[model samples]
Target chain A: MTDEPRAWQVVLEAIERDLLDGRLRPGDHLPGERALSADLGVGRSSVREALRVLEVLGLIRTSTGSGPNSGAIIVALPGGGMSALMRLQVAATGFAVEDVVKTRLVLESAVAADLAGASPRPSLAASVSLLDAMESELSAAEFLALDAEFHLTLADASGNQVITATMAGLRSSIESYARLGAASVPSWPDTAARLMREHRGIINAIESGDSASAGAAVHSHIAGYYAETNFPTHRLDDMPA
Target chain B: MTDEPRAWQVVLEAIERDLLDGRLRPGDHLPGERALSADLGVGRSSVREALRVLEVLGLIRTSTGSGPNSGAIIVALPGGGMSALMRLQVAATGFAVEDVVKTRLVLESAVAADLAGASPRPSLAASVSLLDAMESELSAAEFLALDAEFHLTLADASGNQVITATMAGLRSSIESYARLGAASVPSWPDTAARLMREHRGIINAIESGDSASAGAAVHSHIAGYYAETNFPTHRLDDMPA
Candidate 1:
């Protein structure tokens, strides 16, 4: 509980308090860097560094023009903070590919099961469309991207915000790993075809409102992918995509 | 991308850039308040605010004093961040008791299943101890905390850092719900007794290396709890715990 403060840290705190307390809201513009420096007793460089981190998290939008609206404005980017944090951790920790796959299997299966049981049942139409798009995707990179999107869409349709966010973060963290792993498969077409079939089974279960089948389908779909390979590993940062 | 930067957001981005680039590692002290204010061109108040949020997220530790170790230090506190964020989000979202139970079912059951089938197998002894602690806890709050520790331990045993973190986050977020829901039961002792029994069953399954039994036991434990109350609903913020 020491009280010696860092100038930029203090500045960060000031902004966060406003957001939590409602003094700041999305789309609100902040004071200029120079004004803030004068008021907070910190150097201009420290302030710039702080803002850069927030931008990376997608919490604020920065404009460079001389217009009134050209300053930093508060904006809420979906899954931005979560995505950034998980990606950093993934890269930092160097988590294994098997760990990721198993986690995915657990997460997606849960989502699918929940979706199956929801009284009003979410639509899998969007998921079906994504799967359809993936079927025709030409390159491994493109196919992988669409594949990630498809899973994300399915998670989103589950309507559980916490699960949705967690699933998205995990998926995104491994998105690059997944792409590289996909590229390494000796039979890309065969793997893609297998994935497509799995996706179809999952969608079918969800459409039929069969929670058990949906959960089982998603579980097998994910487990099968990892089983086919000995969980081929890749460093997320080293991934080209 | 507009260039008008929000003062605090600017500070955030700057910090992120440093973190991503590995310029600042854990335990590095940031510049003092007045100096950073001067550097970043933000008010002292704003810098303070941003630091608060970062602290809440478990990214940095801030101490105020008259000595060398008295400023903000970049330190890793993933558990703290996950716990705090989950608590806040659960409060804000007003998730149902059933939602929490459902989530636990999915995560814990899946972990059990995965561990059961693991080639070399993993230990479930630590989780068993946690369950025992929960059983012996004198108060509802204490029991709830131990219960969370139990599940987190299980997640770790699954040997997936990603799922471990995710499970920890999910459990922490709904901790209040678990506490409140448990306390809300007609007889706290009876409820605790039932939970202990269920935990024992799951532990036995895990100890015997029966993956299917472990998964089934976990699922039954969670599903049974929810069924007891017919999935009682409550406002997230007003949850008992």
Candidate 2:
């Protein structure tokens, strides 16, 4: 007899292989647990375990009760699931703050550049509106929320779901850290003003279709703010200003 | 009373919060399932379910039997779990091949530039060795395996675990598609020769510390090969050369 956990893994991989090869697709319902267990020569419990993991990973949605939709159905990767996974991993692994910051700079700057380079150019309406909203008096938490929305909007404008999902995943951790870092600022008003100006500069660069300028502005905007914090700044100095 | 699935989600989020806030870390043993369920006011099954999801995500390692070492121990993010999740999502959702290819160009180019810019400079010995190994006669599957190793080696050289994990997650899908595309090549030897030349060019650029050349070579190297396949090529034309 197959070992219990290994049996589930085998079932998972079999289903995944079908998905990867295009034999399974979005909107398709997987066979019932009994059917899958019989077909794959595994216990029903093993099949259920595999389906549960798939549901958590956002590869499928599972429903209860007996009906045509009761089994697992393939679906688009949910952004929320991706974000939660990223946040959990970052938290659990304790990735260096510097590495996370640098990674963000690389990803976001590229996003900005891509948005700027799009023909006919993508609209920055959502991002610009967030910047305008930032001009109002707001607490650090409120400001950070808008700041995240602005960046996420820009990521969306790049027209890449993978980049957008990654950005979404990183946003919560970035916000929490930014909140903590805000407590150490010598002058909140000055920092807030500067951040607003930088946000506008990023928006203007994208609006003007200057990919290089947009990329540079995003890089400095991120690196400059992080430099003020106690987090190591030397790692970022190597990046072009 | 909380429903079964919701209860597990609560337990999952509770553990996740601890991990995110630095209370839990790699090598730390989680409380026993019975104790955790009692403390959190849930059934033991919920705790077990949560632990199972965490293990599958590679956030913890669980061993059997009774001892200090028996319960789930927090662990660093495992690349295998991330890769499996990504591959499954890509497969089930049918993420447009064009989008996946463009995302690779953006990420791999940045990885190349970072490797080129590292101080004291990273060695390309491992990557170069793979290129040398590719010169020998090999089947499509064999060559693709080496090809993946070469790219992964470069990703590792970039010194970012996050990027490396993302690249690893994308590798299998990339390999499978490349294998399918290879069947259409008019002459395997000529295509293999051209790919070898491009690999040499990428390695040379990194070795010479030319960030721009390295980035451009990677971008074009990916785009040029994909252009020959039935996959959409127009998506790449908009990307910066």
Residue-by-residue lDDT tens digits, candidate 2, A150-223: 88899888877777776776666455677777777898888989999999899889888899999999999998
- Model 1 DockQ class: incorrect
Q: Candidate 2 on B1-241: residue-level lDDT in tens?
A: 5455577788988998777655677899999889999989988866776776777777888887988888789876747666766667666664555666777788899999878878888988899989989999999888888988899999888777777776776666455678877777888788889999999999889878999999999999888888865553222223232
* Model 2 chain B poorest ten-residue lDDT run: B232-241
TM-score, chain A only, candidate 1, equals 0.86
**Residue B190 lDDT in candidate 2:** 87
TM-score of each: 0.71, 0.86
Output the lDDT of residue B196, model 1: 88
Q: Which 10-residue window of candidate 1 chain B scores lowest in summed lDDT?
A: B232-241
TM-score of 2: 0.86
